[model samples]
Target: MNKARIAAAPSPAGLAFRLVFAAAAILLALLSLPQAGHAQGIVRGAQEGSYEGNRIAGPVGGAVGGVVGAGVGGAVGAVEGVLGIPHRHYRHRCHGYYDGYHRFHCYR
Candidate 1:
């Protein structure tokens, strides 16, 4: 029974493989750090801008919009990071209306 158990146990090569696989997995996880806020913001902004521009105009407009959007997004992201403000989510609702002077008002 003991000999049978020993034969059934994993071989040294199998153990080495498992260790190498685990190490590789750990290394990959470590390498894939979360993107910075500004980077994410910029990417999102550029994509949105490009889409809108393409819908409204042509390729030239899309390019221009992408550049402008990226700049704005980067600035906003930087400010949010500095202020320690979390990213906004659509789940939150705000009640608002336009006032008499064409100014918008919001209440949460």
Candidate 2:
């Protein structure tokens, strides 16, 4: 059969079915994210806790503590990712970087 014949075979119902399935799949993926990130929430909660602690721990200590804590958390997560250590403590998003001529998001 020619391509046109194959293309014309399905009716509107088929098209609607495909669209609904696609949408449901997308919704499922989107809904799964927060549940997936519940582990990351622990790290985020810790970050907030330290931030609050810093306020009480004194200005100098707080600033130092917050920076060190966040940095260590991110770095440790990155290393664990490389080493295949299963964790969900932090979520990392890669924003595109720019050189004079280029921009890229490295996540994908």
- Candidate that would win on lDDT: 1
Residue-pair clashes per prediction, in order, are 0, 0
lDDT of 1 by residue, 11-53 (tens): 8999999999999999999876545644787898899888888
- Where is model 2 more than 4 Å wrong at Cα? 1-10, 35-58, 67-108
- Model 2, 1-108: lDDT tens digits are 656544557789999999999999999989754443334534764576578767878776666666667666666655555466776554337654556676554545
TM-score of each: 0.49, 0.33
Best-matching candidate per TM-score? 1
- Candidate 1 TM-score, C-alpha based: 0.49
Worst 10 residues of 2 by lDDT: 33-42
Residue-pair clashes, model 2 = 0
Q: Which stretches of candidate 1 lie over 4 Å from their true place?
A: 1-35, 91-108
